[model samples]
Target chain A: MKGVGPTTPAASQPPLLEKEGRSSRGAVRAEVLLWLAQRASAAVLGIAVLIHLATMSYAVRGGISAAEILARTRGSLGWLLFYGVFVLAVAVHVPIGLRTIAQEWAGWRGAGLDVIVVAIAFALLALGWRAVWAVCA
Target chain B: MNRAWRARNHPAYWAFLVHRLSGLALAVFLPAHFLVLGQALRGEAGLEGALRWTDSPLVKVAEIAIVVLLAAHLTGGVRMLALEFLPWRDWQKSLAALAAGATVLFGLAFALALVGGG
Candidate 1:
């Protein structure tokens, strides 16, 4: 996400003792899950981004117009569903990427950081869904 | 300094840097993009006003920038996926250059469309 650094930075640490093993296991599990989620969402987003770019390039031929934008999206179940999945993937992908950046650059870690990022992810979901609703409704 | 520079001065490093920056930029842009789209919820008039605002020359330039950043992020992402999944190849290192080129070309095409009255 951020640096594409070692995916299992902590996992590689040889657990020299029981305490180290126990402490790192949970963090490693959580990190590995997040890494997988980021990659999976990236796959989804890659396709979505291509579709969106192509559509927008074609749609804006006569300059952007409100009518044109809304007409295509309004009451379109396909668009609604497509964007719903897109937003869900985005909500998963973004916070985890930001978590990596925050850790590397700002040295933020621990439960406090995790809580804030989860809130951020929810905020993204709400905003993204609102946009989808705006277009579809 | 020399050793660190040697370590960091790879094409993949540059690709990583661009990907991170573009992702951050897109994250910042998304909320604003949503804000504009939410204008539609207010009614056609509101959305129309927002669309009219975007017709300005300045917004057009920003639009191009956004498109290019999007291309950068996307191609970088694709490159990441290929690197992660595919068997390693010496030519894969060239993917960084290919991604950069593709980003520029994608932006150029969008700009051309815009200029041609799109």
Candidate 2:
């Protein structure tokens, strides 16, 4: 029942997914979803940033030591998951947004873009996890 | 000459300009953030002293302004994406106008609340 419009060559033909590229309409839908994902992740990161900033101010004002902060974070599921999602969103969202700029500015696409994006994602993940470890471990 | 003014009037054009401006502002502020927090690596007094510096009204004002810029940048970015990617081009102009109004309103509300509280 998928993609069975008037363009169907015959009943015996393969499904659209078996084809090389996603259908034009399907590609547009995917792009729209990607845009939404990027925007939603940005909003999530914004809220997280506000919370992080306010808490940092409060912590310093209360004279909480670094060790004390670490003590609070250690083994805390809430902090772990909050930062984990933060890192994940940054990894996914930043590279995808950068890919657009790269395509427009550097004329890079396809495998080149994929490789750069993956590299950026892993780099961000590594840096983020390192900081998280310093605080949470 | 006229073309330049016309481009400036375009909502998308202004949004792009604001995004770049906000990005620069954030980039500058982020270094100061790291430096202030780096005081924690020293001792409690050092960290506390850095925070006392933050209690200055000037820093508070700058922070509030940055928050306003961030909100405007974000709202504009969202509107740009909607106009570019969505199937609702006919409503883009009206939606863009609404977004601009929301940006100003929300930015002011947030800045006033946070800065006043700070």
DockQ, each predicted model:
0.62, 0.13
Best by DockQ: 1
Q: Which stretches of candidate 1 lie over 4 Å from their true place?
A: A1-20
Q: List ranges where model 2 is wrong by over 4 Å.
A: A1-40, A43-76, A102-123, A130-137, B2-8, B23-52, B84-89
- Per-candidate TM equals 0.90, 0.56
Supply the global lDDT for candidate 2: 0.63
Q: lDDT values of the candidates? A: 0.89, 0.63
Best by lDDT: 1
Chain A structural similarity (TM-score) per candidate? Answer: 0.83, 0.66
Candidate 2 lDDT by residue in tens digits, A52-89: 65564445443335555656676788887887777676
Per-residue lDDT tens digits for candidate 2, residues B26-118, read 534543554554565455465556667656779767766776665665666676666666886577567667767866776566555554443
Q: Residues B10-111, candidate 1, lDDT per residue (tens digit)? A: 899989999999999998898889888888998878889888977889999999999999999999999999999999888656899899999999898888
TM-score of chain B of each: 0.93, 0.74
